[model samples]
Target: MSILLVDSYDSFTYNLRELIERATGCAVFTVHNDSYQLPAEQDNLDRLISSVDAIVVGPGPGNPEQSHDVGIIPHLYSKYTEIPILGICLGFQSLCLVNGCKIRLLHEPVHGQVSKISLQGESSLFAGIESGFDSVRYHSIYVSEITDNIVPLAYSEDGCLMAAQHVTYPHFGVQYHPESICSNMGAEMLSNFGELVQKTGQKRVADKHLLNVQPLILQFSSSKEFDFQFEKVSRKETLSVCEIGDDFLLLNSASVPGKWTIIGFPEPNTSQLITHSQSSGLSVGVWKGASEAVNQDLWPYVSRFMAERKFQPRIDDPELKDCPFMGGFIGFISYEESAPQDVEPITSSPIPDTKLCFTERFVATNENHTFVVSIRPNDDLWIADTTAKLNTLNPSVSASNIPAKIEMPDKQQYVESFNKCQEYLHSGDSYELCLTTQCKIHIDNTISPWEVYKSLVSNNPSPYSCYLDFGDAKLLSSSPERFLSWDDEHCQMRPIKGTVKKDSTMTYEKACKLLKIPKELGENLMIVDLIRHDLYQMLNKVEVTKLMSVEEYHTVYQLVSVIEGDLHGSNYSGIDLLKHSLPPGSMTGAPKKRSVELLHELEHQKPRGLYSGVCGFWSVNNRADWSVVIRSLFNYEDDLCSTASSRCFRCGAGGAITVLSTCEGEWDELVLKLNSVLKVFK
Candidate 1:
């Protein structure tokens, strides 16, 4: 189905287009608020309105009583009675004004805030959503009273009419933005509108063609040690590898050359994404990409191609099927969209505005069994190569020496940085700052990326550890913290806050003292709040599943918290969830934007690259899981190291800096976080 989205000059109109298209599987065409008036454009506007199945009047600034504020509403209401129309925010007030109702400025205006709503009764637009839904509001005016021609179906806590339908025509209007992240069940509510469009006999059916691809499956036994598997795989080729637990190893090496490229923007429309996958003729692949900043304009997106399927927002409950992890997209999106519109680039840095890679084959193993799926032939699969490669192992050179003395920020220099963070906190510029430093290690051809990954995992067996070998770039991560995860059913984010490394000099009780420290507790609370705010953007009611608690990792006893909420509706995808919670809070600090700005000014290092970001996968079924890129190492192809005297490797390490942070304490924390990887070199 096609939707005509009337843009009314709101900053969030584009966000609305993304939400509606993804939720309804409809083609949304947008036009400016004044497009109807220009003599040259009026003919085009009329033709577009006639062609579309539905018309959505988007939110905007200014008084709705003024004709110029929303001039398109009156024209559409008078001229088009057959098309389904839904209005939002300012458009809601316009709906009221046109239908002989009253609209007035609210005594207390709402801007970027969540409103608790109470539904009047059963309504088509709010079918699957709860009675008391939490929704986002960005308006100064509201529908104060409704006439007999309009029936109110929902109200805000203050008794203002929040939603209503025209008594005679199939028309609806809402005071809150269902397209917004703050609307907990916004996707579902928006999907209800799509159903209304279908009831109008306007559903567009897509043509289906059988997926053009061959399926390949291979399995490995989990009983084999990871070290053994690593050695065997390294001898063959570079592929993507994932550690699900001590038992499972998933590897993908189905290489289709010249298919990879760097992607910059997030495409949230499922229909367009499906078209991209179908056109490529590969039903499954993984896209590892990065964005300099996280905002509507630029987001990291993973297109998980599943058999070149049509847009399927919801699998009917009676016909529901469980889909195993099919390959898809995953990667990190920085806190900002790109460089600020006017800022200059950091000099001589090879890092581009974005970086990504796509892949289509994988081999998975667990304690009880091994599983493999690849697009390649049987002979090219890992099962055929493992035993032979194992027989040829060289034990003498398996353990390489520490290539060179590692260089890190000196204690004194880091202390100064810590003090500056405190000053920013005191100045009220930021609540917390995650100050980080880089450690460099120079190597030669003798260092094996696979061996390094095996060493890091053995030393620090983390729940979210992973390894990726992109030929020119290699990633070895031992991240314990889960950045976020979402299936069609639920959305979750777990942020790690406090840390205290294990020490023989101190008793376990003394070591646990870090959990009880006021500074640590405060830091945890601040991040928890930040996470809650981020969740509310795309969800309705975020629940703190777990509060401050101590969890033991391989190297540190850490304070962690879990916060989660239901996805707005099945219409929402894993990409939607990640976009709402990019640049994980624990790493970025509280009051996100201000803190990130401070880091840009205070930290002297280049853009964080993949460090402190996240890495994971978005499955073909729209389920996803990812890890914060902390306690991790990413190797970019450095011409200087590859062709010159020695090969240099870089890794980032740091901690959250708050007003309560001590210079010595933060430096100690930084050293402790890097210790697990550092030991590999030792």
Candidate 2:
């Protein structure tokens, strides 16, 4: 059934929408209080109300007395009398005012964390609620008394009206904010209202409700190996297949399956497909896709296939080309694949003493630009369970779907941790500094590494460099500063050293003065010298392409200089060069090993991972292109917590610190760099 939500602000409306959708499993349409463009107006609100089963009024920061100006309650109640109407917070106050009740401003506002509420009766609004329910309070006024037609459902210990329902009309109101996380039984409360609306609308009458089934658990015996066998049958010849490691096979069908069909294929990759005749005790069944195709008629066929095979299916990646079996299909029998089986098991041995390695390879290069790629495998692997751990150590590289180990932290905890980090910086505990340098050379701005970034696209622009389009062998970037570039015979590296205000108020002379600071230029030149030395090891001759020079980029001006050299000998592979010179001198400070050592000691862990690590791709012809992956996010398969940004913030300060850097200045710089990355939220 269609549900209409009325609210003024976007955030409020979004929260309400999320709560209702989660509770009812129904599609909800938002009607902005200020949306005059909606076809339904005061004149025809009755007709519009007649079209829907229920109306939900959301909470917002506004005076309830101004209801006449907005004409929301009048429009809804006047139009539909028999329909279920749930008013939340401000909406609740308006119901009281319009129904001849009195609202008085409280001497003390109830912002949050008030006492428990006591219900007078088991009203339909509080049908499933326990005796004393806790709810988040955020109101400056309270209803003194209920109108004659309204029946009170719940109230605070002090008798402040918290919830009430109209005796005759299907109208309800709640003074507490139920859509917030702080509200007790928030989702259940909304679900209660949803059931009322669903019953009134008769949207799913006669349809058998699907029960939520528990996830299946497989037990393994002494033999680790298992497999399943099936027949492969298809209506069409050509098909798209995706193999996700040794786990599952994704087959795309060209035509929809009309009846149950057996799919036969090769034995499982890792284990033998056990036959159903074997007494190994295994079962398989299909489930309809729970995502976007939930209500689609085609899902049952897909669900049948899954039920028969006992395989969980994932939504197809939309970015990839569509295959034939996208809508739905039928598939074959299966057997459990045996786990690993070995006559002789290898003994556990101590991990060999080896240094964690960082490799930076040259992906693509031009006369004036070069793309350097680096990978920190662990950053993409480690998963944090708690918010506290995420706050203490910032991770550089991360993978998507990594389940957050910690429960969701409150907003106040986020604020406290953030402020504590700031306090530490202000207390001279650490410094904010980037070891950076750049080259002075002409470049094809269109083809420069910075120009091709994904974040630089017109739809979602970013403040940092990004990688945009990658087609076959060619790659594109939109970097503000030149990192490194090279050709077949020669290579060059340029690092950004200093940053100045972007506004016109900061003159070039002032920028130059700021650039000359020992802490700023000193670290920058050191990195430049390091890059020059790294290139010299692989080149026959090396020289400064251009000394320190100034370049204007997006939000700020930068000091950049160039160094170039010819490839030393034929023996040098791009991989060799990357192995020797990794993590570019610009991101890590001078004395590369020492800087990294200190960073590990001062920061959370080693292997900056993806944050400071690089991302891009290699080409078939060995002409590869990649970016530093700064201002980027990693999605993991396991990490599924609500506050993912806390982890993002922890890894954000890795690039700040130098011998000459001050804690306060370093904090400021870190905040500045973070702003460049965090502005995406805005």
Candidate 3:
């Protein structure tokens, strides 16, 4: 196969030429500028172009907007629809320009800089590479706006689009020079592109209208509709669904059967459930795996795994781009990831160490709109056909009338646990401790998990509420506390510490009572200080953006505080932040590490799986947001059993115990926090 290397004279052309030749195992045909040196004009140009199997557009000087500078790009782009074309820097910008995307001059042009580039979703362009890695960047112009035609593949730490691919063709572009000597694993990137060309030889470009399947989006009006669709779709054994805010995501695997894998703890690797399957669906695994490596935490593992697979139609919709709940891992991480070394080691837990799912059959729904995205290979038709089917799903069924009963530790037991926590606080062994206990509930199999989620959310209406149908178990949470939220520019953590049940008799009077309580303010301040310390460890400049603020939820009023900081450097990752500041301070207590240790001992060494953990999404943009796992219920049903009709369902509740905390008062707080969850049974 012949390869064409177009030079833009940026002093790296010759090196790029050699790299392409080596990667593709073909002799490079070099051309300076757009014009061919052949004696004839049109005929020679055609002959030179037709001789090549693939094209690599090398980085160069000047803005690609100047048509004269890179006029050949648009021409070659229009002509070479079949062959694979890789664009670098200037060529990358030109490709975006030709595709109706906007370009802008960077205020600080990247030159000889080594920056971390996070691969967005998955692409054949970056197969076998980690999610985020350092790459050599040298450019003045960048693609400012990505149109629908271009699917962004990667981004830099500063949120600049670094790599992208055509929506319909095998055309890929990178703002950084993969041919540069400084780029990490530079040669591997070029080789992957070459292999893609060889593998997809001589196929005619399909019509965009018939071939490109628009993303399927549907909306549900009421909880009844949401429940009906979930029950209908989840009848398929391999289907999954999740809820975020008012949105419900129904991910069906029936169209492309067996395109999923289920994994649990002790092993972090994916086991293929369907052999010889090429359809791209999702890899949903819980983070119960044990890892000695400090950096390979749950968030990092999910991000890396999601990046390794090449799912098709990897576009981030502008409307839901900021919705962190889309398509990455959505589940819980145990407190163990950050638990103190001295803590009684949690040997086993009823819930997985962590549960995260990587799905390309993404559905984002709310009260208003439902957006469904299927990235399965050659399944565009399936995606289009399913949209109407999803919308037309019957909502004839009403909420289940199954009887449910709640089981919790008796009042005496709770008082004893409360006194133990206060003793530690009074003795100065710990300043404050978040003592928690699990409440078990037995509901008839006929009771829909969806109904429970519906009842809790309707009553509580928390901002961070979510429902997860994790294959083995169902998780329903209405948590008001934010574990953390990170974008490319800043990192933020919001902790909810103080809680007071809403009093109908009083309005401002209730707010004043909660606001004036020294115990409440002290609890909030202690965690704030701990979180600030955590941020100081990983961030450059830490600040408490909001402090001791009262935020009212439907069931109760809470004292919340916000802490933010700039990421110290690009080297810090989501996993790093999670590792340093995990088991969120509000959940653990003042002096996070020691508090966790004391609680582990105090709670009978029982692991808090999915309880007091976190449930949220890690985005493809190298950003993530998670909610502290509280005010939640976890259900693990046994469908495989022949005679078993009952399932294990548990909900967790806790209160911060300080020296001034009364035993009866702490018990009251725990019950108050659980009212929303318990009211579902009533």
Candidate 4:
């Protein structure tokens, strides 16, 4: 069977698509609700609907009362009466509204809540499915009054309508998300829909214009050889890469759980890859002297840059193979850097939206395990000198209280923004809004950027902590969230949402007890669904490997979840997938586009800068790793276009404001996030 799932811009649309494909073992195609309305797309749209055996109106944000929100959905059910159809959430409400029922706003909205839903009566949609199952819901509106045509098939524990079916048509609807990872028997529900499709006896030919499938494995290189080819050094001695330097990167994992670190620095002979800026078009190879400029946007530009990476031989050392960053591009993508032209950044940026470095050599190490250095051909003398410098370098970097002042948005201003976010949440404009505020700090330049990075890691060692010195901008990050990472086989994303302060009395058990409730987990759940949607494309199957687990950090306990999907053939490159999933879902909210739009109005146009952006490396090998830049302080070279005697630094902090969030509590959380990094100044 071929199913055409009309996506209503919901985060879980892909989740539903995968579920149907898994349950029915059929080819499924999808299109955005407003996708084909254009005059040029009408014929293609008609051909698409005619090609599918069944149509599923996917759930999404907003009310069915608004025709623009639901798009061609009303026409699909009304015009194509003989075709089997299934409506979910927004789709469900759309079905009810067309059948002469009203979508009423819930007095108490349930954005990311789980509840028991019991079957109402005998119905083909619920046949063979377990009754009274826990299903995840992400809706703020409902349909309670059923007329003769609209019949309730299931109801929640509190008696709100959960599932319904049309008495005279092959149309069905469900209030809860059947495709949620946390929801039970989702496959069974989709299977029942398949059976209903069969009973309808619709004989339709599959569409020839199916979406092309791409290969998962990515392979491409600029040249057959790099400035330095992989070779082994004769001497074996552990060295400290902690020594501070200019235009270098340290992916520090010191004291962080189950982590490795990489120190990336440029070799003089390979100076072409010092800095990356997307402000203007890029010239491909300055080393060649007659290089050509590439006229592409940020993400596409990255894809080409990575595709043309210099080649390096494989290092068999168990240490180097496991580390994803064996030395490549190291830099930060500013928060608003990749925002499409449609979404204008509120804050005027102080620096280019992006800054990256291509390091020729790097050292990978784990304190207790192994230290592996990348060796190139004809560089024995350089390696010996570097090894000697690292061996004799002092590892101890003491913390200092160097006086610093912090600036912030006042309580009233923040509270007002918080209140506005609440209104948007209740009105269904967004499920959760990540409201952010930037803090400025004036610090004495007596301390170097590398020393400041050492202080950050010393104060709050996090799994994704790192330091970047790009000459123009220096980043000191102690972020704990892994935004996205990929190897040859699969792509993984770990999002950190909930936060709890750590004290002497806080135990792992206590943290779990305090952080596992519906209110606390709701924010995390919305982002989880959003990320699943983001990654659902080009996926064999996505899994929530770790869900809602409270992990301890230096200053706080956080609720983290890991979601991963296998990368398919060369159809999509690592950069392609990374760019497709921009803005990091956790930093945004559910129904991401709308939430991002609403946040523009709520955040008062303050630039998030590097905060909430991602930083890491894309290796010469087809692999990459990045961490969400958070809990960090950063500085751009002053007006002199160089580091000054005193530097002006910025720290960004924010909290996800959901319907359950209180203005004061959110303010406190924002303050806590800010203090987590600012304490390094002490």
Candidate 5:
């Protein structure tokens, strides 16, 4: 069986595709609603959807009345009357518009909330599904009145139309999302639709249908038969990895529990992959033996490079088993990455849009052991030298004094941006926006970058804490959020959204109570749904292993959720998911593309640079892990800093702006985030 899903440019289109595929055991393909079908003319539609057994008009963010918002959908409905169509959310609203029914705005919008809906009568779509079942909804408009051609199938508790079907055609639609993790029996609903297509007896079901996929827990992979050329002495407690090399890249999770800490040196003149609009072509940085980027896209070029090195680990030590990466590329991608991928960032910054370095020799440390490694399986000489150099442990040195005070973002500037953010929210242009601001910091030669990272992590211990010394510049991070990580073909993303200052009055229970409110919960819930959409492309089912729950960081309490998917389940690999879901959804709010646009105007067209960007590694062994650069400080070399007596750095902070946000409340959040790193200084 096969199905063709026409996307309306909504983020959740993949989620619906996954649900339908799992329910029917059929292959499902997705294409944009604006996908070159001759703009509502049937010249190309016939050839486009000719082989599909069913058609699903996926939900999106606009009104069906606007032809552009739902391009070529009304045409599909008019032309394919017997194809067994299924409409969801916005798709449901369109069915009414074309069938002489009305779509009216709800008294109150429900963006990420669940409600019980009762099935109206006998229908194959809801055949075995019980009435008064719960389903998650994200709609502001609904079919107000059902015409004679349409028969009502269900209604929400608030008396809004929830589900309906065409009286004469095999068309079905539900106002709520049947693919949502919170939605009950959604797979069954979709399976019922499939059986309807099969039975053709008022679309009767022969027996029973079931849907399944267990949520995966993110686990650090263990190494097997990893033959070490020499034993690496354990000295991580007293000796910092920085003491071994002057120019290095490190993902240090030493302060955080149950995480990998990898440190490696970038040899002078190492192979690099760099991209910027200023460059002549992406091929300029391509590795010697690798093919040049096609039309300047680095995605496929990098994909091929990784494919050639799909290395398998050779670690034999049980204590050294937990480290995911033995050796690979460690790098950063600017929030608005370079051309071929992005048009132009809101504003340019000192750092390159993309900078990655290949490191073949490195040391990986877990909770119990530090493993010295080289990518070459038989490089015995290099291993022996590295092992000897790491034999002695030395104590970490502290800075002479706090470098300097910060130049914080002005309160008035934030107030103006907050006002613009609210205007968009109230106007319905966006549901939530992750508003952010940047500040500057100065440091003298008295303190080294390593000392600063040591102090920062000591003061604010976080799971994703890191320190990178790129010689001319450095990054000191104490991020509590994990952006994305995958071992083999399984991938996971943990997004942090809602934040509350950890005052003395705050307890775990109290924090949970406060975070459960609409203001905080809405911020987190919207991102969780957006994440599901991002993972939909990778799997037939994206699992929420851990739903929105409050987690305590050093200075604040954050609402965190774990979303995981399987790459092997679909045609996509970890690279595909990573490329599409850039600038993490939690950092950029709901309806990502639109929120990013509004953020530009609200942020005064300032580039976030390395502040909100992710920094980590893509290993040669097909494992990837990264952390969102938050509650941290970033530095990039420039002439101003070189001439000045002190080096300069930038730190960013802000919170989600919703209708519930206020000048005073958001101001407090901004200060709290900045202070998380700033407190390490004077």
Candidate 6:
């Protein structure tokens, strides 16, 4: 059945569309009262009014008389006599005028938050309404008395006509907007109208013209030979797909108008998969309708695409050596009646078809078991497409894979860097930078370089801290906060500054003083200013919603600040924010680009990999929430180590320093923050 939602303003029309869609689960069309264009052709309009199951005239900000000027009410009533029609606010006034009711202008029109309504009798529109209920009212003019064909169904406390129904016709009108949330039973009222349409079997205006076919399924698998060919092409072309989970993540980065859309599966019935847990991060998309093409064509292309890249393990880097392969897993419990005395087999498996392969190999181990798994691109990317084939095969026996462990550098360099930082602090080159400014420092000496490489994937990440091991110099940090996260519309940045010692005599005043240091304050203010400027470029009405505030957290106390604004007219993507505001303000200090340059000069290192980057999900709604990669550890396995003994961890920390900063104090701060994680290690 068709429903016409008439409005005089665009906002009203937009809202009506959403309300009607939600209420009826049916497509609805809108018409503007003042438009020179009518809905469809003139002949079509007559047929539409005759066949339409219902018509809903929406409320707007203007006077009800304006609706007559456009002849909207007259036009609707002239052709349709028996159809169920409901009017709201302005529409109600139009209904009253057409039915010969008196329209009286009030000194102050009731507008929002009026009073309760009292139902008079068994009315079609008020079928489910109880005697007394609160509802929003908005109008400058109201109907004073019932018209000839209209029968009053409800009234306001002051005798104002709140609702009236046609005595003989199926027409209904209300002086309040039942489409708004403020209305007591708005959805129920709309749903009642929908039910009437269904019961009457009213001829519906055809809408098949708007229907479109669903897209074909695209699948990937690991058993196809063509997958290897595709891998060769991707590798030769230097295509890069994100290696998330255990599969080689592949995307068409080179496609023109490059857009990667993921459609998730229908909601699963499993309670474990349905819950919101960090262990079971939400799935991206779901597959539907199995097909031969999905198995043969799509799977191979994915497998080949993943094979083209090589994984590079950074042996010298501590963060990589200890990085954990962070991804969610789902377990299934199957019980057989024949084995009633035995407990059902409970097995854990990664979410299907969500795996991505890194260009490297990592030693994977579950619990106490360990084994080396080569994560190189499968001969066929189709292998990654496990949802279809794997489910069809019998479940595997329960057994844990042994993780391989590799040797990494020892505590000698870390000890040396720590001692050097201490010496600098004593020399008085600078005063104490905040103690929380340390970055992750690598400590293990036996993890595979590739295992470290795999830990950079930013899925299912844990809070970690690490010290960057750059032979001659080191950069340390203990970050457990998100720098910035955004989807399409809204963007957020949680900048962490200021720090207090965990076991020190620091009071709130001392903590505030530490943050308020001229150098520290200046640096923080600069970051705020930079963030404001960045947001200004993307958002409208930019404002410092929340200025510098002290937010006490579990592990430490931080001086945090918030800056926000609406995404300006432009449709900004999550990747846009990531590229613009990365390596967090807390880590980079004020004058971001300059601080980074100084960091590069003062600290000897290249890219910090995932250690300093942001990690979070960018949802389809164009919204996202991510945390800065800090207070976390990455774990890699040693390939040479026996299955029983191969796992390591890497933690990091670092602080912003200005020329006024004392080397000795900076070193001490780094150590203090580094201890925040090392203590967890012990």
Quick one: best lDDT, which candidate? Answer: 4
Angstrom error at residue 536, model 5: 2.6
Error in Å for residue 591 of model 4: 1.3
- Tens digits of per-residue lDDT for model 6, 465-497: 222221111212334464654433466676765
Worst 10 residues of 6 by lDDT: 331-340
Q: Taking the tens digit of each residue's C-alpha lDDT, what string does model 5 give over 1-682?
A: 6677888767677778878888987667677788765645566567656666777888876677888778888877777898799999878888878899987766566766778989887998888878999888777677888799999999989898999999999888888988777789899999998887665433222111112222322223444423444356664752365677666677777554436677866666545544433333354343323324436566665666666656675567766656677667787766766212333332224345565667777777777667777765577887777677667656677653475857889899889889888766654456678999988888886666778887887788788777765543467888888888886668999998888889799898988988888778777877888889887755655788998888887788889899988766455667766777788888888777778878887887777877778888888777888888899888776624433577677899988887777789889888989988898898
Error of 2 at 116 (Å): 2.3
The numbered model that scores best in TM-score is 4
Q: List lDDT for all candidates, in order.
A: 0.60, 0.43, 0.62, 0.74, 0.74, 0.45
**Rank by TM-score (best first):** 4, 5, 3, 1, 6, 2
Local accuracy of candidate 3 as per-residue lDDT tens digits, 1-682: 6677776644455556666766767656667555643234657666666666788887655567665566477767777787789898878888888899998766555544568999889899889999788876666577889899999999999989999999998889999867544467678888898789778664332211111112111111221111101111322111122321122332211111112211111112432111000112223322332223222334444444544532222344544443343334445665554462333322222234555554434555433344545433454664555554555554433242336776876777777777787556543345578899888787766667777766666566566776666455567777777788776568888988877777686575677586657667766766775676566444446667887788766777778888887864545655567656777878887545556777887887765666887767664444567778888888654422112565557788888877657888788889887776777674
473-566: candidate 4 lDDT, tens digit per residue:
6788888888888876788899998998998988999999989988889989888888887777667668899999998888999999999877
What's the TM for model 6?
Answer: 0.35
- Model 2, 163-261: lDDT tens digits are 888878888988876754335877887888888887775563221221111212121122111121111122221111111111121111111111111
Model 2 TM: 0.34
TM-scores for all candidates: the values are 0.54, 0.34, 0.54, 0.91, 0.86, 0.35
lDDT of 1 by residue, 1-682 (tens): 8887876655456567767887888877677667667556778666676677898888765577667767677777656777889988777777778889987666545544567889998789989777888886656677777899898999989887889988878778898877654467777877999988988885643222211112111111222111111111223212222321111222221211111111111222211121011111212122322222222222312232222321222333221123223334434333233222223233233333222332233443332223333322242434445434333533422353355567776777777778887666654345567888777776665666666766666676677666655434456777888888777568778888888886666555776685767677667766775676565444545677887777766677888888887765534455655655667768777456556666776665356656777766655455667768788776666534343555566677888886667787888889888876788786
lDDT of 3: 0.62
